[model samples]
Target: MRIISKIKTPGALKSSTSNLLGRFRHDDDGAMSYVAVTGALIMMVFGGIGIDMIHAELKRNKVQNTLDRAVLAAANMDNTMDPEFVVQEYFRAMNMSDALSGVSVDQSLNYKRVTADGNATMPSNFMSLLGVDTLQASGSATAEHGLTKIEISLVLDVSGSMGGNKIVQLRDAAKGFVDLMLPADGSDMVSISVIPYNATVNLGDTVSQYFTLDDVHDYSSCATFETNDFTSTAVDPSTELGRLGHFDPYNSSTSGGEIAKPWCATGQTSAVIAHSSDADVLKAHIDTLNAGGNTAIDLGMKWGAALLDPAARPAVQALSVAGFVAPEHSSRPAAYADSETLKFVVVMTDGQNTTQYDLKPEFKFGMSEVWVDTRGTNTLNDDRFAFRVQDNAGDDSDVYYWLGNSGQGYAMKYQNRPESSAISNGVEPYQMTNAELYSRFSIAAVASEFYYPAYVDGFLTYDDYANAYYGYQATVNGSQADTNLSTVCDSARDNGVVVYAIGVEAPQAGLDAMQDCASSVAHYFDVSGDDLNDTFSSIARSLQMLRLTQ
Candidate 1:
């Protein structure tokens, strides 16, 4: 498209031609079109890069979170979860399988460490056109365990109901737990106190000195915990709170036999085994646990928490000095504020609460019943008296009057009788009725009237009349004991003690009570068919996790 024809002067023609050529070569008319296309391309590239960057960031965050969780799970002290599999599983669960890689675990005698690293390639958009196919994102995490000092009180229910296979299962499970918590070389910082409780807690003879020592049943190895013990979470043996007594079943046979069984039937005054790091010792003590006596869970729980309380430190020290408790654990009952120290109480029970009986301090040394009879004569009736006594005195007399009718009453009408040394005289008979004299004197005076009846009616002691005098108080049963057990459990929980309650073949009420006593709903277990081994193992695993987290 050229219409060519130009004529000008020689000088003007050269300048014009040069100007035309320069304009044709440097013209900006089409430059705007090319710039617009280039600008659009640049915008696309930047937008694609921004999008890819955001995608990479999101993928990296997801990978990091997943890896962290996987490592923690793999690092669980008691779990056998594989590190690589756990990491890959988590990634798959999150639908980020491409990011899973480099998973590893390092386990030691007392520690576990898990590490995981993962990478993902984020797809690029317009950047791919420039040879940028994808952006790589990576994440890594490591979880490790620290040495945690744990003090556990295994409060087992050695009640009559936990007999036979249940006890065996408990032993095996408990020994397994001990193995889990205690190091094989016995060099770890874990201590366990095995407390087998029933109607009462056996503190033994030496341990008795640590307590206030209720001398009523001083000869026994067990102690009946009072309501105050339940009210107070810590059982400070240094305080004059609880009393030492024989484990006397509420309604046990009193058929003129040997002394009542130790309240908890702890074989031959088996004193409580204080805190120990020796797993064998703990297992041995657990094996010695026998099932007998009524259920006094409160006592068991109270002592369990007590041994973990700092208030019992002095007692622990004393016991350690006396070689009763191990020297290393003498400083036990570490302060509650110790963050690195963990305290646990595994309370196992098989029955509901039962009646608990305790003996009074003083011997039951009085006559139970006294009666006066009027005999012979008309004007003045001669009064003869009868007396029955059951002596629980220290004179080696535990026998009650086993005579025909001498086993009936707790106390006689009079308390102090006239001295047997006093001369017996056939004096005068008062005009008072027989019942009148019977109602007026102390048990002792009634004894005098019976042995020296001449003073009242010029009559002799009757050889025929006899009656029984039951000395002990009536047995407490049902709701009373249940309330006691519940009260103690509440106290234990209130004191910030972590209680893991296990109910084995127990009544509904017992299961409910155990569930309520637990630190949380998840902390309770009910094994009706006697699968206590699994329950204990689960608890041990949970405890191991806790230790790892610490």
Candidate 2:
């Protein structure tokens, strides 16, 4: 039996095809695979973008760090090369020279400021798919090296203990410091005041004229400050000060044109050279320093702080007019609140504070009881004598006199009835003032001739004679001097003044005092021999104020 295939009509085939298509569209099989492929594509895009962003950040950080270092190095005051060149070299060393866009340098006599800007362009990797062809990394930095105005006070110890090699080393170290601080081009922005101190601070005649000093004698220009003066940094020019006596307690004779060594040094070497920018003048003054007196670190610090105080501006201006201070520094000792100015004080000492002598108020001025006969030879018993005159009535009535060896040769009391004829002929009695007495004879000679005779003649008691013998007394003891130093040091720091102290082979007390006076522990130096030079050099480096501003 042969069978024939049946064929469907066109309409029936179309209906069957439609039914198959609908089933295919409704089926859920393999639907998860399509979602999985879309998710993977999204994840790949995000990961690539993150990687490109991290790479750009790394490049940005590198540019910023390199620019910061370059500006800082270029701003260094000690860098002799061109600032722009220095910055360029720094970038070249980092192999990022092409990234440096620009460099700017601003410099003055004592100041230098540098600014740098850089940018790096990196090709975008995965980010390119988002139409970003390149990424830019940019950085900027600024640095400042020096202060606009710098005032420094060098308080050097020229005491007897600083003799020999110690002084030589100090001179070399201090000169080296000057060379570092003061540029050879003669910068007007820096001024140094050299205050060489020992028993007292000698304000040179040019500087002393700006102050109101007691008119005791014209022999020296040393002022005796009160205890309260150390509590503040100001040395008011209008403040009247007591004058130290010009008598020497060591020598007994004024023969052979020998000058008395007064409590205050009289020579130009020990005097303060205020607010000078001339290194040669300052070094010359340092060369003349001779160690011969006791230590007075307190006085030295006081003058050092005072010279940096704004209250002393008038005196500085006066000094400038008088040619002692540089004319460009006439306005110096800028206000403490001035942001553009910086002040520093360097105190060096080899010993602790010693006795500071001052004449008693009674002996400071006015007539003394001692009398001299100008006609006789210059002998203690014949020429100079003291009279013990007593008013019996207590109302300027009858007076009794005990004449001291005026050729009468006896301790006899004579009534007021003795006229000029009663005494020996040609024996002219001259009542000398205390100032005159001290000016003519040494303190030792006066004590020997006058005080001893008064005690022997029963006019003065033994205690009274002892007091009179030592005309000068200690004004401030060692302990009190140390306290004064602390007070001044604190005031200086409070006023924004940087204090650096050095103890060169000093005793324990001296070292402690210097350490306490320093602004911080790092600001104090304990050294000996040649180490002082290194200490000063370190200080010079610290004072340059090199720092990054941005």
Candidate 3:
């Protein structure tokens, strides 16, 4: 229809065209409508362009505000800042009432990924007639804080239970931890300690300088059993407590129970792997460790104290023939001091203290009656609390706490007595019986009498079993355990050491141990088997950060 109209108007258009051409050729002053209409069209187009540009500038300002705020927030995370809180506050700061208050922020780790959704509402001028009332704009930005150096101790449990798929899991977890601590490319970052503790930790060959091994310790001289004297001089070897727990039918041992075998490495040793160096070597070592022997947590922990210990480095050099300590620049204290170095012991065990040695015992069997005394095991240290009452099933009623004083559980078993310290005149019993129980005795007298009972057990001496096989002397409270732990922790703290505790499939006893050792409850990790990796990584990161950074 438009084409037919143009064709029909051709004759009329020729007359109009001639007039328009004559005016343009002369640049005529009289004809002004054409110029006015053309100018109006140009202005209309430019008005829309101006509106678009203004919208773009506003969007750009919003993006800049988000980027600036997010970057500053990321930087503040290094001061032990909470990332979540920082993200929330930063975005809030970027959003303002007069400006973009509806800005949204997405946070992760230490950085904020921000997006600016420009206003969906705008006051349109010339463009509004095109059926557009508002224009939308958007942009994105990222910010992050600088991380510092870290020192971490990766104390792992390489005990018997960690066999099977567990070890494989450990390898993967350990590698992950290392990867996390390492700087992305080049940064003087973190250091790690891989301590694998079983019955005894193997500090490897570095031990001779710091330890005296079992060969030097006579197994027979370790400690002795009960008071009764047997008619035959030779007792069954089966009843003997091993130097290390007698090897289980599963453990490598001629006898079933090897008393206390060495748990810590013979020297100032710890886990072997790539430490502060390459990853594959350390991971390989972790993979290679076999879960073996009894769990000598105390010994393993003490050795853990040594490997990261600066004091032991000097001693390692003294035993050069073994070639355990390399005489290199890295071994120097200064070399170590500059880098963030962490010492950690992640000990996990499903057992309790089994091996207690260094005492003696003497027992005599009299016709159907067993009379027991100490030939070994106890040594007299006035400071060491000796259990005044013996609490075997037959004797619990006769013991001290059964009568009273349950909270003061850590009784010093006189450490120096050659014979049973319990019955010795120098050793007194804890008279638990109160004065109320004693008609003639005053409260003071009764308290003194039972709290320090004169009638001691002859077997309670320097030479007795630390404890009998499955003979659990009830710990009235966590007193004894706490004292032992407190002594170690305070000493370490005095020396500026940070002690961490891990409860890995641990019993209440183990939990107490970790609590006793940890600087605070937050530093302790109570975990089931699967959570071990998470716990390990958390510890590794903490230790790494503690050492590597300010």
Candidate 4:
């Protein structure tokens, strides 16, 4: 009895231990309890902060990428605004859709900085337990057009063959280009040197010091209509080529022995075309043009280059962009910073090269009527070209290769003409043979006269003959005599001139050349038979597109 009482019962001891454990679990007491509660709360707060910061960082990164892309797009500044709108809109959409909103592009100019900014609000994922609801993120981007400058030269073909529709289209397009290049705002920065061409460009007395007998071929003197007033009476005053017969600048007596008709038809045609910067003057010149002349594209290009030579305008150089610079840029090193101004060239042509082969009158007795074998090929074969020999009258009698199926027989070659009328008197040689005989004349459209020889055999198919005629006149051996116009263009590019080529109604080779000459293949445009306004507008659109991209 005494031992049991002293040891205390096992049940009692167990009850005591259980009570202590329950108290420990239920009571908030002591330093350990305080430490546990504080640690958990701290962790929750930190987790919320971490999640918010991560989301904010992501939003900022996204905004940065979009702004970078948009700025780059603006830097390329060309004539088109569509691309710029598309680029800026895309980023704006992304910003609005994502946690971000209020993204926008401000001041997108070629030479100026393009800027973009955006902001975002995102919910905190892990921090919700700590009462933290959201976080904010923002970003910005900016870019600038480079300091490269440029010099532009325009080598345009205004040959006699470009008379009708082609000339009209060119006048409209060229003027549009000038308007585009004109300073949209500010004192004009870009400089232009205009070269209006024919067999020779007319520099006028102001630049006549550059002209001399050396510039003329054959006659020892260029036949100025003013110098030969008596013979120029038949010339019309409304046409550009015809303008030669009169003189500009009113004088009691003008250049021609005859009193000048106040103004020559073509004299002001490109009126003040090359010499002035005023839009009104350019407009007047554009109004006066009437196409007429043999093509001398080489001479035209050469003179165009001369206008932009750095040595010519030391001061204007600072206003020019160094290279790859166009009209739309916002800032650049001064043009006068270098020896030359920013330079470039846009060469355009409709008809191919043509040399006056022969202007000899048909009335000469026993004289062989000149015939040009217009069967020129793109592929140069020595044997086919071996017989080419041009005489003083620009006549090439020897046949190299023919490009046709001969029509009926020899008799059909010479069609009906009254034989008694005499071939020497410029009678239609084919008509002299027989009334019923259908004839085939090569290049009949452009050539003034057609001749059929006595010993001729079968005739060629009319279709083949026509192609050979016109094709030859416009290709390798034609008015634009060189198949390698691109070589010259590329050379010009290396010398600081950006080359823009337009292949309007062009052949494959011509297109290829244009692609190579353009700043890029995308810069090249092919315009076939189409509306003039639309064609010019298409070109304008392209120019704008290029500005936006590059």
Best by TM-score: 2
Off by over 4 Å in 4: 1-58, 65-114, 118-138, 143-151, 183-187, 207-276, 314-342, 356-484, 506-516, 529-550
Give per-model TM-scores. Answer: 0.63, 0.82, 0.42, 0.45
Over 27-143, each residue of candidate 3 has an lDDT whose tens digit, in order, gives: 857666677889988888788768776976786666555545544554443444554445446556656323333434444342233333223244656566667665654434444
TM-score of 4: 0.45
Cα lDDT tens digits for candidate 4, 1-550: 4655467589999998999988887875662576788998898788767867887888777776776676566545542454446456757677554533433444333344455555667787766666777767776665544222443455666666667787778777767765655434522444445666665455443332222322212111112322222211121212222112111122232111122221212233332123234445454566566666555454455445544443333212322333222334223222334543455666666544444222111221122222222123222121010111112344433232111112445333332222211333342222111101101222231121222121123233454334323322211234243433444555556665556666667556546656766767655667753544465555443333222221
- For model 2, residues 1-550, the per-residue Cα lDDT tens digits are 9899989999999999999878776885865456778999889988999998999999999999999998898888878999999999989999999999999989987889999999999999888999999999999999998745899999999999999998898888888888888878777778999999998899977778888788878778888878898999998888788888776767786341233566666657578999999989888888888787889899999999999999999889998998888888999899999998999999999999988887776776888765555445554434433343443565544323434334564435433322232344566666667776776567776666656665676756887767767787788988889989999999999999999999999999999999999999999999996898999888987887887878
**Where is the poorest 10-residue window by lDDT in model 1?**
463-472
Q: Where does candidate 3 stray beyond 4 Å? A: 1-73, 76-149, 163-168, 183-188, 206-276, 315-347, 356-486, 543-550
Q: Count the backbone clashes (under 3 Å) in each candidate.
A: 24, 0, 98, 60
Q: Which ten residues in a row have the lowest lDDT in candidate 4?
A: 431-440
Best by lDDT: 2
> How many Å off is the CA of 539 in candidate 3?
3.2
Hey, what RMSD does candidate 2 come out at? 5.6
- lDDT of candidate 1 at residue 346, scale 0 to 100: 94
Better of 3 and 4 by TM-score: 4
lDDT against true structure, model 2 = 0.82
lDDT, residue 104, model 1: 74
Q: lDDT of each structure?
A: 0.64, 0.82, 0.43, 0.43
Residue 349, candidate 4: C-alpha displacement in angstroms: 1.0
